[model samples]
Target: MKRRSNLLTIGMLALLVYFLLPLFWLVVASTKSTGDLFSSFGLWFTADFHLFQNIGQVFTYGDGVYGRWLLNTLFYSVVSAGGAAFLCALGGYGFAKFRFRGNSTLFGVVLAAVMVPTTALAIPTYLLFSKIDLVNTPWAIILPSLVSPFGLYLMRIYAQDAIDDSMIEAGRIDGASEMGIFFKIVLRSLAPGIVTVLLFTLVATWNNYFLPLIMLNDPELYPITVGLAAWSSQTAGGGGSTGDLLALVVTGSMLSIVPLIAAFLLLQRYWQSGLSAGGVKG
Candidate 1:
């Protein structure tokens, strides 16, 4: 048993290192100057620490365009995630509790949609949006992001167990309207599941790259992911200022992940409970 425990510990340590190594490297690299990046070992800091300078350059470059991308990302992610979570909760709750015509068929369709890749739908979605004259707008990104088949599925599974039919019936007995019951009673019961879907959609929309890249032609509409990729492409194209741009990209990359990390840390308990409860119920 002691030997098995030792092996488990080693395995856990290895997994920790595997996940955190890149983040560690990013922190180290972000502190180094462009020249120090290449000259010094990647995992360690050097004499020249330009962390703040690199961050300043990241914001000030191209007349503070990175800050604009940051704001765009925040808007797209928050709006999309919040909307998607609410919609998913509504759909999932209905599917879980209500009896309607063609209910099984519609639920099956949602299940099928969960299997379809978003990348496969991107071009078709773009074309549809173009016809509606919504292309190259924030809606181009936000509208598409609001549809999350996986999140719907997750919420459905969670709602099945998290909410009780008797409780809902009791709310109705108390003269609560459908929407009122959902807002006051059902929502409180589904808090963990809602949070789980919110975090999933939030992260997906935050790191989204290809959809925005293909949909938005305006740089002002670019998210941090695409803006950083653009800077990376410039660095690869080989200019005399490539080094400075490279450092800015590194620092920006590190800064971009901070919000995601904080989100995970803050909502981890709810996320864990949601997943575990859903798994057990499913």
Candidate 2:
């Protein structure tokens, strides 16, 4: 038993190190000048830290392009994720609670849509949006992101367990409308599920690169991921080597991950409890 425990502990530690090594490297690399990044310590802190200088350059380079990218990303992430979550909740609630013609068929279609790779549809979506003159706009990203089949599925499953039919029936008996009952009672009970869905959609939209890559053409409309990639590529190819955009890219990558980490930490309990309840009931 002792031997097994020791082996398991070592294995877990190794896995943790494996995952964290890249992040540690990024932090160390971001502090180094381009020259130092290649020449200095690969995994440890530098003797001379240039983090502040690098950050300044990251903002000032290309006329504050990073700032624009950051704003675009925030807009896309918040609008798409929040909108998608609300739509999913509505769809899920309706599917779980209400009966209508072709409901099962529509849900089956949604399931099939979930099975489809979002990346695979990017080209077609681009073409469709182009025909409507919506390409290169924020709507190009937000509209597509607003329809999350998986989120809808998650909500349906969550609503089925989190909300009870009896409550809706009671609300009806008390002369409450469907929307009122949903808003007043069902929604409150499904708080955990809503948070879970919001986080999932938020992370998905925030990290999304491929769709935005295909949809938007204007440099001014670029999200941070695409914008950072452009800068990183240029820096990697030694376009100008103006204060190590590459280093800032590393740092920016590190910074971008912070929001995701904080969100998970803050919502971990709700997400876990929601999943546990859904699983137990399902």
Candidate 3:
């Protein structure tokens, strides 16, 4: 038993190091100038402290375009994630509580959609959006992101476990409308699932790169991820060697993940509880 315990402890510690090492490197790299970044040992601080300088450059570069990109990211993430969560909740609640024709078949389709990679659909989506004149607009990003099959599945499972049919029936007996019961009671109970979907959708939209890159042509309309990638690309083939855009790219990458980290930290308790409840019940 002691030997097994010792081995497990060592294994856990190794896993911790494996995950933390890259983050440590990114932090250390962001604090150094480009020269120091290339020359110095990774995962350790250098004598020069350039984190603030790099971040400032990131925002001010190209006439403060980074700030615009950050705002665009915030807009896209909030709108898409919020809409997706609501839709997921509605779909999940309906699937969990009500019966309709071909319900299981429809859910199976959703599961199949989940298995399909979004990247594979990007071109078809682009063509469709172009026909509708939505390409190169914020809708191009927000609209596609608003449909999350995984979120619907998660909410379906969560609703099944969290809400009781008896309560819903009682609400109906009291002459409450279905929407009224959902809004007043089911919604409150679905809080954890909603937050879980929100976080997932938020992260997905915020870090989305390929879709926006394909959809939006205007640099001003770019999200942080795409903007950072553009800056990162400037270093290719010795093109942006005259500027600190590469350093700015690294620092910006570090800053870009802050919101995601903060969100997870704030909602972790609810997220964990929701998953546990859903798992145990279903």
Candidate 4:
């Protein structure tokens, strides 16, 4: 038993190190000057530091374009995550609680949608948005992200246990309207599941690259993922100023991850509860 426990501990530590090592490298690399990056050390300490200088250059270079991308990413992430969570909650509540026509069939279709890859739908979505002149706008990203099939599925499963039908009925019996009952009773009860869905949507929208790559053409409208890719390409192409875009990209990647980390920390308890309660029948 002791041998097995030691082996398992070592294995888990190795896996943790494997995932964190890349992020550690990015942090150290972003702080080092270009010369020091290549010559001084691969994973060791750098003799010459350029952390502040690189950050200044990242903001100032290209007329502060990185700031624009940062804002766009935030906007897209907030809207998509919040919208998707709300929509999923509504849809899931309706499917789980209401006795509507063809609810099972409709839910089956939604389940099928969960099986479909978002990437496969990107081309059709781009075409549809382009026809409506919504392409190249943040809506192009935000709208599609709001339609999360997995979120719908998660909410459906979560709503089954997270919310009680008796509570909703009591709310209705207490002179509450349908909307009032749903908003006041059901939604409040499903808070944990809502946060879970929000986190899922936020992460997906934040890291999404391929959909934005196909939907958008204007660089000014690019999310951070797309913007970073463009910068990487420019690095390869020897673009103007020869600024340390690599460092900026690295620092920006770190900055981009901060919001997610903060969000997880804030919502971890709710997320854990929601997941644990999902599909757990009374």
* Model 1 Cα lDDT, one tens digit per residue, 204-223: 99999999999998999999
Which order, best to worst by TM-score?
3, 1, 4, 2
Q: Candidate 4 versus the native: TM-score? A: 0.92
Task: For candidate 2, list the clashing residue pairs, or say none.
Answer: none
Cα-based TM-score, every candidate: 0.93, 0.90, 0.94, 0.92
Give the lDDT of residue 266 in candidate 4: 87
TM-score of 3: 0.94
Q: Better model by TM-score, 2 or 4? A: 4
What would the per-residue lDDT of candidate 2 be over residues 45-119, giving only the tens digit for each residue?
788898888878778878898888888888888888889888888899999988999999999999999999989
The TM-score obtained by model 1 is 0.93
Winner by lDDT between candidate 4 and candidate 3: 3
> Where does model 2 exceed 4 Å of error?
1-11, 241-243, 272-282
**Which lDDT value does model 1 have at 45?**
91
Model 4: per-residue Cα lDDT over 201-271, one tens digit each: 99999999999999899989998899888887877787556556777777777767878889899889876
Check candidate 1 and list the clashing pairs.
none
Q: What is the lDDT of residue 107 in candidate 4?
A: 92
Please identify model 4 stretches exceeding 4 Å from their true place. Answer: 272-282
